[model samples]
Each structure stands twice: as structure tokens, then as C-alpha cells.
Target: MRKKTPLNKQIYLSDHYTGNIAKTFQREKDINILQWDFSVEASLVVKLQIESLLNYIVKNVKSKDERRCKYLLPLQYLFRYVKKNNITDILKMEIRQEKEYELFVPKEVKKNSGSLRKFIEFCRRILFISNKEIDWSANVWYVEGLHINPKRVSQGTPILSFSFLDITNSDNRKALQEYVNYLICVTSMKMNTIRIRQTYARDFFRYLEQCNLCIFDVDYQITVKYMKKLGTQNLKSQSYNIKLNAILEVIQYLQTRNYIARFEIPVLYHKEKEIHTVNDIYNIDEKLDILQKYLYLFPETLRIMCLVLINTGVEKGKMFLFRDTDFYWEEGTSWLRIPGENRSIPIPSILYWIIIQYMKRNKLTFDAQLFHNERGKKYSTASFADAVSKQCSKLGILDGEYIFKGSMYQRELCRVLYRSGTSLQAIREYMGYSTEEVVKDIVGWKDEKVAIKTQEFFEDEKHNLGGKLLMAKHDKMKEINQLESLHKVDFALQEIKNYKDSGRIISVTELSRKTGLSKGFFYKNDRVREALDEVKNEQKEEQLGIIRKEIIDYSLEKQLEVYKRELEKTKQENQLLKRENEKLKKALDKQTLQYLKLLAET
Candidate 1:
């Protein structure tokens, strides 16, 4: 048989036990005595008497005696104590019935009764009341020292509170009182993003509290409630869904703190139609013109920040991290280096100059933050959002509405540049995006025309034709020089041939020997031999036609050169004639003035 584990002797006390055990016992004894006739008549005298005794002990036992009372006393012992004390006939029957109930009750019910029985035992052990002579009536009457009213809690308690009391009391609390202030005072996020984050966080918490559940016990029902509430509030589905996501983050935080047990948060779906519609470029231009008026009053840092955001589409938080060292300016190229991803973005020269002017006007030192507050601290995302909202409101752009920071503006600028023929790769590098999707969204195109044009411009046959023409001209000139030299040699050979024709025969081998020419030299002198043959055949029948063609080609080249010179002379004459005509007109006007003066004098 397996050995049974012993039961724990420790007794737990609940809210009921704030008084002395003796007084509680006496009250139970008195009630039992008064109700003895009814208890016996109903055959429940013993059960009723024991129940009263158990209630008394649990309610009034002192902290020290509480444990002993719970574990030592038995129902039979209580009956023996009543009999030994010679308790009245009325009480005897009632005590017997209590003993019978303990002996015959179901095990489960008896186990519950055991707590009361244990309390009595503990009282007996602590009070040193002998089991044989214990006066049940006297013990019951000794109930003067008990008091049992519960204390009321006055302050409101958070249903899902954590121990952030110390944090609340901290000095940073003043700075962190508002979401915007916290972001500005503690973190290095842009003001605009901080506002966005704050709006999301607020919407989330509001949704949570709005549902009547504690943050800890937020369930599917509460989520459903929030969804219904959101619908009733007439918020755009997208905006509502965004707030739901932000709220879910807070719920996740709660889960981390052991406040909630399950991960069953509901996700909100947004309709496509709920997304903000974009206006035309004309409206954007008008808005930009209105925004420019505020640049004079706003700090230079904020002015440049707005321009950079509108032009570049960098996230507001990322813009806060930008430093002067991030900019690379050399050889007419200006690029900004983004950390984290290590991407470099080329900026427009015009925007670069505007940023330089803004920096100079601010009297800021080089390497100082490009976008900072009066204290030279970067604006947090929330504060930047608030500032943007306020500026938009002042310009009548927002009109108590929320507007996204860079998306629409970036899309518009990208489209304009793309349509004007900027390359896709250039746009990708300019926008600091890792992928081309954003660029594609901004400027839809099958291919970049500028890149194709640049490629063709550099490598096209037409562009290389000038170099080819120069090479061909040089080759032709070299060939002409070689031919002329061969013609001179041919004339010398023809003179020797003339001597041979006059019966003074000169063999080729003899001519080669006389000129000290080797076999290789003879082969190379074929051009000279050919020229000599042509000279000899100059008066021969049909061979003169070939000579005549050569003469015609030489004459045509000479005429072309002469024509080019005549064309230059004609252009000069045209210019000279124009100048002479202007001078004659001036002289005529002068003579006419002189004649008019003479006429007036006459």
C-alpha cells in the first residue's frame, strides 16, 4: 500500500476571525441552549449545536490559538465536555445530535465540518481546558473580547494596477505628464511621429476604459464592445483599426506583467474606402504656398524639417537622428547618409541650397542638429506631429483634421520628377528606399527613358561616327603616301625599260643585281613594276582608258577643295554686304536730317 502523506497542520484565517474565541463560543452556547427543544424535535439538535460552536471559534479565535483550534478538537470531545459539565437536559440532547451528525454525515460534508471541529480543539489546547472537566457553558459565556466588523477601503483602486507608484512620483513625471511632452523630454523621436503615436495610444486606452472591464480582465466581450463603440462614434474604419492596433500593444504589455492570462485580443479590419483620398497637384501647390508664409515666424530648424519631409519622404523619427556628418558634399554631388541601413541618398541641388540657407540663418554651428528646438534638442516624434498639426491648422490645411506627414507629398514630388525624365535607379537612391516598390508607386513606368537615352548617347554608332571617320581619313592618307612613293620608283623603273626597248635589253634579274635588290625586295617592288607597265602602255590601244579614269579622279578631288573655299568666300561676302547696307542706311538718315534743317532755315 502507498504511504499516505500527512496533512498540513497550518490553519488559514479568513476575514471573519478578528476577535477572541471565548466570546464567540458563549454566544453559540446561548443560541444552542435557547433552540434545544426545536433541535431535538427535528432530530438535528447535535448538528445545530456543533454548527453554532464551529462558527463561534472561526469568528473569534485569537491569531495565536487559531491554528491549534483548527487541528486538535474532535466532535466527540465537545459532547464529552458538555456531559462532564452536567449541561442541562435541553442542551444534552442537542450536543448528542451534533455528535451523531459528525459520525453519520457524508465524507465531503464532514470534511467541511472538520474546520469547525479543529477550531474547537485548538481553543481547548490553548486555553488548557481539560477534556474531562471542560465547562461548555462557561467557555461559551467567556466571549467578551471579540470584535468582527470589516474595514472599508476609501480610495479607488485600479482593477489592473501595477507598482508604478514610484515612477509616478519621479521628477520625470512632470515632463511625461502629456504624451507629446514625454516624447520630447525623454526620447529622440520626431515631434510629428510622437503626436501620431500619442493619438494611437490614447485611442487604445480610451477604448479599453470605455468598455466597462478592467484593463486586466479585458476579454472578447470587451473587445466587441470597443468595436461597437468605435462604429457608433462614426470614426473611419482605417483610423479605428489603427487605434485598435495601438490598444493591442497596451494589452500585450499587460500580458507581460501577469495581469491577463490569455492571448485572445481581437484584430480590427478596415474597409478600403476608409483610406484618405489624395488631392490634385494644384491643391498641393496651393497648400505649399500657404505653408511657406509660416516659415518667417517658425524656427529655421522646423522650416527646414518641413521642407525635407515634404521633399524626401523620410520618416519623422529617422529625420531626428540625422546629423550634419551624415551629409556628403563633394564635386557638385550632395548625399545624406542614413544610419541603421547605411543607405546614402542624393538630394537635389536646390533643396541642398535651401537647407544651407536655413542652417546659416539659424546661427547654428556646423554638426549641430538640423532640426532642434530652442534648447538645441531634437524634437520628439510626438512634438513634431503637434507642431505640424498646429501649422496645418493655422494655414487652414487641416481644419481640425489629421493629415499624414510624407506619403502624399512624396508621391506628388516623385511623380513630377519622374514625368520630367528622372531615372528609376536615381529615384530609388534619392528616396533612401531599399526596394523599388515605393518608387514604382510614386512613378509608374515600363522603363526609365533617361537611362535609356544616356546609354544610347554614350554607346550609339552615330555618336562614335566622328572617331570612325577620323580613323578612315588617316588610313586613306597613309595609302595615298605609299602609292605616291611607289609611283616615283615606277618612273625610275620605266626609264630603265625605255633603255631596254631601244635594243639595250635589261633583264629583271640584271636590274635587281644592279640595284642590289634581293628576291624579297623584288617581290615588294611589284607596285613599281606595275607603274612602269602602265607608263609603257600609255600609248597602247585600250589600256589608256584606265589611265584616263585615274586622271579624272585626281581632278575631281581638286575641284571639291576649290568649291569648299568658294563657299567660305561667299559666306564672308554676305556678311560684308549686310554691314555695308546698314552703314548706307545710317548715312541716308543723316543727309535727310541735314536737308530738313536747311529747309527749315530757308
Candidate 2:
């Protein structure tokens, strides 16, 4: 069933898509032609995807019994819908897009949406292998599909979708896929995490497209705008943080590859995560007391296991796998060797005696299962915890809810030990953890209120250096040096002012001669140097001002002479106008007299 082929052979020819898709895969004997319902109206790219997908399934599906149409139907339903809706880019299709065709397809294929997701995951991987960037450049990828580890993901493998609200650019769509590739291959992000990341990434891509921006155009300001956009959506603080982290990861990747410049994003949107305060840890003691009150209700083995869990707070997995050699005596003190820890933590004396008694009564050897079911098989962590929760429910704790989950007791114990004055290093070893971070969170190591108080204390004293000096135990030698320097600076400044007032040239040499201070004092002392420079600058400014005033006065005198000549010209023009008016009046009077004489003659 397994056939090894060259990586090049696995790559389908892009030219093969031009011809009939059926004829291209007719020679692929493993493919069942009847199962494929290729409509005549299907476009070229859709036809190519359908053909490539069949070939991929044939190569990957190993057992003959598993090669059924049901396994292929989910993607087929998706492709048919894609073709019907005239979608050209399969890479832009989302996992939940199949729901659009739900009314058109049978309910069985709807149930197979999970399988469709797995197929999409396969597509993403193969796309990465083909282009090394998940660009989806080719119609098909040249790579083998491997099974995902079931233990890595819970609730089946999580799937990602690329269809965003406004992702119109083809390259940006491919870039989103490339980000998915980075998450999968490079970061090994869990599918559940990818799903969450994909949500924010989709929002980001849609945002970029809506703003008519590409990845290269993203900057701190652009991210600020994006944050404002998220803010407008009225997202929760935690949800907003997820959005920030998702976009930050994308921005960092683009910057690393030189697609965008690196810039710091303001963490204004950041809100502190809710943590278990010391009071919360104290409150958990009430539940512990309840469990202790109902301790005897369980069978002896379960009761002892419950007691050990509550007292030791070891990880459930390691506790379930505990053996006879794990418990020992060190210098008359009882110690329990946690698996994976270099040193052992001391156990309660009474609990230690009970464990020793249980081991002896069971006749357990050094590698034998100390705690087991009736069949003597090792008990699972899940089953052991379930038993504890069931017994607690019968005793009426937290309304029948299983509150004692993974590492709850361990976290509680870490906080308790830390508050009880145990060092972080001791707590880390006690909890079988490799670092203090685990216990750090449980103990609320970074106190925001304390940090704020410290900051305020520093800020208050920041400008109060006088008070600091006054309160300090003074050294006579330091004070004398300071006084001498201050005296020299004062004397040099006064001499510079005297030189300016008396109209004398001022220089470092003149200052030194007047004040009997070293010439270096005027140059070396900051205050003296500044005062000297200021006086010299003022003198130069005064001389420049005088010269500027003389220049302005000369220009004003020239302008006054021009105004006098223009006034004389205006007077001559007015006199000419008066003479012309007199001549016209005389002519009118002579014409009137001539008309009067003519009238008398008639």
C-alpha cells in the first residue's frame, strides 16, 4: 500500500489543468471514477482541485476497508458548493463554509465536517511543503499526508479557516496561510490554540484589507488603529488581549522576515489577568476540610490515595505511577521521592506511616504498582480523580461538580508553602517543577499594588534631593570642596557682569585677572562658563543692534526724499488740470454769446 515516489513526481503539472481533468487521472487505477460527480459546469481550478484531492486520498488511505466514499464526501460536498457558488480560491475557503451547503446536502456529510477540517489541515501542510510558505501557488501539493498525533489535540484536531470579511488581496490571503504554516511547523501550536489564533488573525487580515493596507505597510501607528478598531467592537479585556497577541505574532513574523519594520506597540489595551489571591487560596481550605470530614466513606485504598493527594499535592500522573521505592526514610525523617525531581520532599509523619502500612499489607515490591484496581492493574489519573470527585459528591461538595482538577492541589500547596516562608527554590523542588514560574503565579509573586507603591515612593523623592542631602551624614571634606567650587563660580560670574557694565572686553583671562581665580575655573565650571558666554553674546547682540538701527535710518532718509519728489509731481498735474478747465469754460461762454447775436438778427 505504501509507495515511495520522488518529491518532483508528487508535484502535479500546472499545464495538466488545461486539458480534461478526467483524462488526466484516468490512468490512476486506484481512483474510483464513479464516485466522483464532476459536473460539466465546473471551472478549471475547481476541476484541478477535485482531481488532485482524489489522487491524494488514493495515496494516503492505506487499508482497502477504509477507502470508502464517506471519507471523501465531506470535501466533495465542500468542492461542489465552492463550484456552485463560483469560488475560485480554495485556500480562502473556511472550515465552517460547509454549513452554507448544509440544506443542499444530506445530514451525514454535515456530521463529517470534522473530517473536512482534517482534510483542510492536510491541504495546509501539503501547501507548505509545495511552496515552503503555504502560498497555495500550485493547484496541488507534492507531499505525503501524515497522521496527526491524537494526544496532542483534544476534542478532535482543531481546524483553521482563512475566509475573512474584507480580505480582497490574493497575496494577503496566501500570507495568512503562510502564517498558519509558521504556527504549525515552526511553533508546533496546538490545533485549539491555532483556532483561537486564527480568529484574531482573520480579524487582522480583514482589518488590513478594509484599510487598504498590506503586511509591509503595518507599523506601530497602524497597529494602534487596529487596536482602536478592536476597541470599537467592545471586546472583553481577555478577548482584546488575544487579539493583541495574535496581531503581535503576525507583526513580529513580518518584521523578522523584513516585510515590515520593527516598532513597539503600546500596551495600553493590556489588562491584568485575574489570579488566585492569598484569600482565594485560604478559601480553598474550607473545601479541603469538607473532603477530610468525608474521608472515611471511601474504600481503604481510595481513602489512602485521597489522603496522599491532599497532603502531598503531587501531580496526579506521577502519583498514579508511584511505586514502593518512591517512599523512603532519610535520617529518621520520612521523605517521598517525586518522579522527575532530583530531591525528595518531606511527607507528613502520619501519612507516611499509613503509606508504609499500605505498601506492606499489599506486599508491594520496588517496581510494583502501589495503588491499583481490583485486577491489580495500574490506576489511571482520570479514574482516580473521578473516584475522588464521586465520593465528594456523595458527601455533598460544590453541588456535585468536580473541582479537584489537574494540579489544583499542587498550585494550592505551592501558595501555602510560599506564604509559610518557604523559599522559591525549595517550593520548586517540593512541587517537582523545574522553575519558579509555576509557583510564582500561584504565589502572586508580582504584586501590582506593591509595585505601584514603590514607583510612587521613588517619584515623590525624585525632585527632593535637598531633603536627601539634609538628612544624610555629611562629610566635611566633600562640603568644603563643594563650597570652594561654588565660591569660584560666583566670583567669576560677578566679574563677567562687571566687565559688561563698564564696557570692558571680557574673556577667561580677564575674568581670572579680576577675580584671582584660575583661568581654567571660568572654562571648566559649567555655571561660570555659561555666564561668561551669555555676557559676550549680549554685547555682540547690542553692537549688531546699533549697526542695524543706522542701516534702517539711512533707508528711511532715502524713502523720505522719494516721497518729496512724488508730491511735487502731483502738484504739477493738478495745476495742468485747472488750466484745462478754465479754457473749456471760456469756449462755452463765447459760443453762448454768438448764439444770442444770431437770435437778435433773425
Candidate 3:
């Protein structure tokens, strides 16, 4: 400035040297030379000038230390300037790379490798720097100064994985297994049903593991995938949907534990169209026949149990509750009284006779159970199912894998009944269904035949005859409508005339007000005209009544005259009969005297 130095060179030297001098001088300086104040417009001009000066210093300063000094100079100058101007100041500065700034950690950090890798990747992406250029030793300084808690962030993925493993290993999983076993043993549920529950649980755990989340992370996508997988098995919609409910139960369990945050499982898609056909029943019957043969030859009570199931369609648990006393023969009806619900079903006469015959042939007492094993004890449900399966295999009826227990057998029976032309209402009653719709679902029957028959009934020749009779009646009624109206009008008119004769002019308004007739009556004057006609009708009816009375009286006189004539004729006949009787009696008496004389002579 003393020699009129170039503005760029002078500003650059001032910026670069001041930072160095400040660092070297420390707190020994009593006077401050860096402070400067400028006017508002001048201040803006100076800021731009300082920015230019810093850029020049940055370009010109070659050494690493010099460049760092150049970077710090603008901040120091701005601080001094703010103090001189009494301006509120905020620091806006970019850090220069220093040798000490680096992330230092072993390349093979065993404990938190995944987290460390992720952190490195995060720095590369967020700071837009190459991995090689990033220092690995820096602990306090971050390039972007972003304070990411490594311990917190790094714990998520591993902890989530461990949580999933823990659940799979826990007693809850054991409980689920126990539940499956119970379903198989006690509930008469199929292996397929158990398999469905297992698969759902496995998939749920897998989903949690893969997503690095708990069961709470399950979403629509995960559920959809599970459904799609089930769909691939080509299961019937109803069967598939029933299995889906088991899966939902597992999800509900997780939700109850607070492990699952959301719940929106899809409901079974019920198809209104009937999918079962006549062939399905035939197949079921064939299976039943095989099972029957096996039970017969094996001499096991389970066979009789299976036969009972096929015959009665009772659930497994309910069947197990049967006792010797549950069966009774009364009034030609052989019935089984179920426990709990206290419902009873009359066995088919044929089945009833068969059971009676079997009991008699086996020398079993009337009070003895119809189904008992060699052990003389009721078979458990599982043992019963196994016996049925063994018998079915022996009979060579292997069309499809059959579950010995569960609603499948009952549903199959329903299908058979439906195919056999059983009415839905009758089926519902027989099956103890709460609603007809449930029977329809179990049977998978369509009401198309009923619908068509209904439509035909309404459109048949009989309906046409009824329609014609109704139409004829309607026409006759229409013919009497005018007469009926005239009669009503005449009555009203007579009343109006009486009113007029009494010096009370019944205006339309007054008539309406008194009779509560509508305004339309005034518009057409129909009421007034009808009233006039009513008077004529009344006079005519009076005259007709007098004539009718006279005719009746004449008829009654004629009837009396005819009665008198008949009475005289009757009296003449009676006199003739009396004369004949006297003549006959005289002849009888003479004959009797002669007979008496002859008797005396004998």
C-alpha cells in the first residue's frame, strides 16, 4: 500500500501473512492492527474484496501449511472486523485437510466389521470422497462434521438378527410345536394343517431375519408372497383359506407379544360358484369303503369309529365323548345323544339295523358301546385315525392322500349328500349348521336348480290360470266401480240437499272444511254431482226394497197353500192305510182261531 501495490497481490499478502503472524505472536501483542470499519455499502464491497483476496492467497500459497493459513485468515479477519463494527457475527468457514484428520481402525476389526464398513461407505457417499483418500485414524474430526453415533447405528442389524434367533430358540416356539401336536392328536387336524402352521412360522422368522427386523416388520408384500407360495400348491380355495387362518393365528401370537406392530392379513376369498362335482363324492365314498374294509378286518374299534364318522359326520372331539349310554333305541329310532350341546341325531334305519345286528352277532349287551377296541377301551382320536389309514391302504383305495380326522371327512360327506340330491335346508338341519350358508359352504352346492325351478313355477301354465282368474275378478270389480262411486255420491248429495233445505248453503269451502275433502273435489265439482246422484239411488233402492218385500210375502203364501194341500193328501193316505190294516187284522184273527182249533184237536 505504501508503494501503491496491486490490489490482488496486496490483499493476498495481507490475508496469508496475518494468519502466520497471529499464530507466532500469541497473546504478547498489546495493539491490534487487523481491526477495520467500513460504511454499509463499503462493507459489502470489502467483503467481496476479501473473498477475492482469499481466493488469490489460496491459489498462490503452495505449501500445505501456507494453504491452511490462507484458509484460516479470512475467519480471523472476519472476527476482527465484526468486533470493530459491533456487528453480530456467525462463523462460515470450510476446514482445510490436515495430516491428523483420519479414521484409524484395524482393517480386520472382528467385532464390528459390518458397522465399520457401513460407516466408511456412508462417509464416501455423503462427503463425496474416495475411500483411499479418507483417513482411517481421525476420531475427533469428521470431514463433514456429521455426528453419527456409531455404537447405536452399528447395533441394529446384529441385534435384530439375534432377536430372531432367540425367538426361534425360545419356549414360544416349543409351545407352537406343542400346539401342532395337540391339533394332530386331540383336534383331528391333518398333517397338512400342521405343515401349514410350521411353514408360516418359518417364513415369518425368515422375513424378520432377512429384513433385519422383528415380526413387527411384516408387511403386505411379505404376506402376499406367502399367499402366492400357497397358491402354487393348487389347493382348493376353501382348504387354502382354512390353512391361511392358521398362519393368521401365528401372526396374531406375534402381535400379542408386541413383536408385530401391524396386522392386516388377507381374508379368505370366498368364491360363490360351486367347485365340487359329482365325481368328488364318488371318490370320497370309495375312500370310505376302503376305510370300512380295513376296520372290519383289523378288528379295531377305530374302524367302527371311522364308520361312525362316515355315518354321522360327528367331529373327532365330539365322537370321543360318546359313551355306551349315548346310543339308545326308542320308538323305532336309533339315536346318538351328543354331549355338551345335548343334540341328538337319528341314525339312518339301515345303519341302525347294521349296528344292532353287529352288536347281537358279537354277543355285545344292549348297553355295550358299539365301538370298542380289543383292549375294551375307547380309542384315542390319533390312534383311531392311524387305524383308519392302515385299513384304507389295505383296501387299495389310494386316489389322494387322506387325512383320517378333521372337517375334511365331514365336508366330503356333505359333498356326497349334496350330490345325492339332498336339499340344503335338510342338510343344514342334519349337519347342525347355525345357518344355511355354512351348509352351502361345506357342501359347495349351487342353488341353480332351485332358482330355475322357482322361475319356472312362477311362469308355468298354473300361474297363467291363476293370473287369468285374478284379471277376471279385477274386471268385474272395475265394472262395479261406477255404481259404487254413484252410491257414495248420492249419499253425499242427499246430505247436501238436506243442508240446503235447512237454509244452510253448503259452499264448496264449507263442505271441504266439514268433510275434510280435498281441494280437487271443488275443481271438478264431482262431490256435488255425486251427492245429487246419491239421492236418486237412495229413492230407487227404497222402491226396490218395497217390491222385494211384497214378492217375498207372496212366495211365503204360496208355500203355505202347497203345505196345506200336501197335508190333506197325507191324511187321505193315512185313512186308506187304516182300512187296509183292519181288513188284514180280521183275516189274521180268523186264521189264528182256525189254527187254535187245529192245535186243540191235535
> Can you write out model 2's per-residue Cα lDDT over 402-460, one digit (the tens) per residue?
54565577676776676545888898877777688877777778774588877667545
Sliding window of 10 residues with minimal summed lDDT for model 1: 153-162
The TM-score, computed over Cα atoms with residue i paired to residue i, of candidate 3 is 0.33
TM-score (C-alpha, index-matched) for candidate 1: 0.34
Q: Could you tell me the TM-score of candidate 2?
A: 0.40
| lDDT of the candidates, in the order given | 0.50, 0.63, 0.51
lDDT (tens digit, per residue) of candidate 1 on 523-598: 3466655644454444332443543344344335445656877899999999999999999999999999999999
TM-score-based ranking, best first?
A: 2, 1, 3
Q: What is the lDDT of residue 531 in candidate 2?
A: 83
Residue 41 deviation, candidate 3, in Å?
Answer: 87
In order of lDDT, best first, we have 2, 3, 1
Per-residue lDDT tens digits for candidate 3, residues 193-300, read: 445565666655554555565454566677667766777778776667665776777766666655556757546452223366433344554455555544566553
Candidate with maximal lDDT: 2
Query: Which ten residues in a row are the worst by lDDT in model 2?
Result: 138-147
